[model samples]
Target: MATEVTTLVEETSAVKPNGGVTLPIYMDNHATTPVDPRVLEEMLPYFTGKFGNAASRNHSFGWAGEEAVETARERIAKLIGATTKEIVFTSGATESDNLAIKGVAEMYREKGNHIITAVTEHKAVLDTCKRLEKYGYRVTYLPVQKDGLVDLDDLKRAIDDKTILVTIMAANNEIGVLQPIAEIGKLCHEKGVIFHTDATQAVGKVPIDVAKQNLDLVSISAHKMYGPKGVGALYVRRKSPRVQLSPIIDGGGHERGMRSGTLNVAAGIPSACRVAR
Candidate 1:
């Protein structure tokens, strides 16, 4: 049976006053975008034609779905200049931020319990750091300069022998200011501290090379690009030892055991494709 799929297409409607028409203008791209007709056409088959559970490994249908998911992972990794193995799919940036901070903090608590971050971070990152503090981990919330940038000297002053990690966002979500990530990374490297950045906004808008920046970990969201919602990725540099973190949720081993769940193969494919572009 063939399934019918309807792609929502939005057309500009003119306003009429006294039988006179006024031009319609689209000025809300920041809120949302019109769905691309081609994407809808490409996704129709997955919804009806070849619907299968990606986590079901007992049948060929499942294998096909699983393969698509892996291919998507590769695409996402390529876009970020990472290996597919380093990408961990999550619900979104919020989850990605939680995993990166909580995961590393739990894993490295024995090494040190101190984590440094900026005051201007998103609530996702800010709240996660606060939660860690409740668990006896010391957190340093460095204030940013008037220009919405963290002072490199403050970052240096915050570091101590007990400091295990430093997390900063690549750019400010509200103010649109880019951080001095490369400089921060260098300082962390010299001090043997792990550096992580929430690159949700910076990933597509600017260039990011993990190696050049000396980044140990980075967080990115899919929908920030042209991809679907509810999916994002974390980049953990393999050259560094795998980030150790306690799982917030216990389940079957997945996402290299850092995150666990049945993978969303459909969202993964398009998310990766969008990032690659």
Candidate 2:
């Protein structure tokens, strides 16, 4: 069965035309995936005829672009069991992870100066936490089991009154090990610490219900899920305990002022549609 599955995946990703290798056979899906044809079709108009800044509120072209962006947001939100208002678009998961980590650290500085995370996290996460350490934040890097799964008891013991966030990845990028996200989320909520997950490798491939899992923040990437590159979103929980963050990129107060810049309407809309579909 494993052999059959591997063959099927290879066939689906590339075709050996004329008994020669495909020019670009991609096996590193953890890094990115080729854009689905359906998503490409959806992205074409935004790049060509419907090109307009989503922030431009006075013109018809802008309105159309804004409408498309909002629809995409709704689609992405529905797919992940989150509200449209909670989704903040960004360039990709690295930015999303940075935003979720640094934003939370800055916003909650007065409340706490400690964060807990597993050692085997994406560089986006580990690097962000490292930067925070330079600024006086204490980070606890929990050790994982032999199978690359974090020990829940270790995580529980690491929590202190000064701990403010628990950041973990939903799936391992290289090894494809699935973490216990729902369990971690529950644990964080019980301790009054915010739970954030870099869901780039897990978003479309696995089931994620932010509400059910009690996730406070989630980072996602479009390219990881058969969508266009350079587009992603961060889901910030709005109720039960509203999650707040400081904007990493300050400009025109876009994305509820969490991320401010001209929206990438062209790639973003198609990315969202791919996730929803």
- lDDT per residue for candidate 2 within 108-184, as digits (tens), equals 99999999998999999999999999999999999999999999999999999999999999999989999999999
| TM-score of candidate 1 to 2 decimals | 0.86
Q: What is the C-alpha lDDT of each candidate?
A: 0.78, 0.90
In model 1, the worst 10-residue window by lDDT is: 1-10
* lDDT by residue for model 1 (140-237), tens: 99998888999999998999999999999997777879999999989998999989999987876788878788888899876666666787878877
If scored against the real structure, what TM-score would every candidate get? 0.86, 0.91
Runs off by more than 4 Å, candidate 2: 1-24, 268-277
**lDDT of model 1, residue 69:** 72
Clashing pairs in 1: 103-245
Worst 10 residues of 2 by lDDT: 268-277
Highest-TM-score candidate:
2
